[model samples]
Target: MEPEKLRKRINELAAKKKKEGLSETEEVERAALRAEFLANFRQAFRSQVEMMQVFDKAGKEVTPEKVREIQRKKGLRDD
Candidate 1:
């Protein structure tokens, strides 16, 4: 689902939990939704980081080896 909708549902569940306790099914649904949200966030973050390139003041590329390796595997960078 969209991030905003996911966030809204999670927040709603959280508010419900804080005000009135949730049933067993609601608790399970909340956990699953939270896990899904985290997975989506991690994937988006990883994609962003994989596409990033860092340069030093002297214009030397300073991206980390792990990130460079990922870029190389994806044919996004040379050397």
Candidate 2:
């Protein structure tokens, strides 16, 4: 999902939890989930920044096809 949508959902969940009065264990779970979400966001942003750096150095467009090919050669698949 998009970051904005994910953030909205997280906020809604947090509000619901606050309304319900979360236990310590539930709070820990929420913290873990939030940390994981932020980590994923950071990784995605880092990959984008790296791609931009590559383009700046190479002075060429980084096509989606090239990205897909790299992922394919690395044995990574959506399935």
Candidate 3:
């Protein structure tokens, strides 16, 4: 689902919960929507992290080897 719509439904369910509460089906739907939201958030964050470069005060790179390896595998690094 689109992120905006997903959030809208989640917020609606939360407000309903605070007011009158949800049925069992709505509870399940809310859980699934939240999980999907978190997964999408994590994926976007991981991509941002992967494309980053880290440096030290002396201009030498101090990026972790694991991150470098991922960059290389994705063709982001030539060295």
Provide the clashing-pair count of each candidate structure.
Answer: 0, 0, 0
Q: List the residue pairs that clash in candidate 3.
A: none
- The TM-score of predicted model 3 comes to 0.95
Candidate 3 regions with alpha-carbon error over 4 angstroms:
none
Task: Evaluate model 1: give its TM-score.
Answer: 0.91
lDDT of 3 by residue, 1-79 (tens): 9999999999999999999999999999999999999999999999999999999999999988999999999999998
lDDT of each: 0.96, 0.67, 0.97
Off by over 4 Å in 2: 1-12, 53-79
What lDDT does model 1 reach? 0.96
My TM-score estimates for the predictions, one after another, are 0.91, 0.50, 0.95
Model 1 segments more than 4 A misplaced: none
Model 2: per-residue Cα lDDT over 14-77, one tens digit each: 9979798777876776786688789988999856743432344567754466665555665653
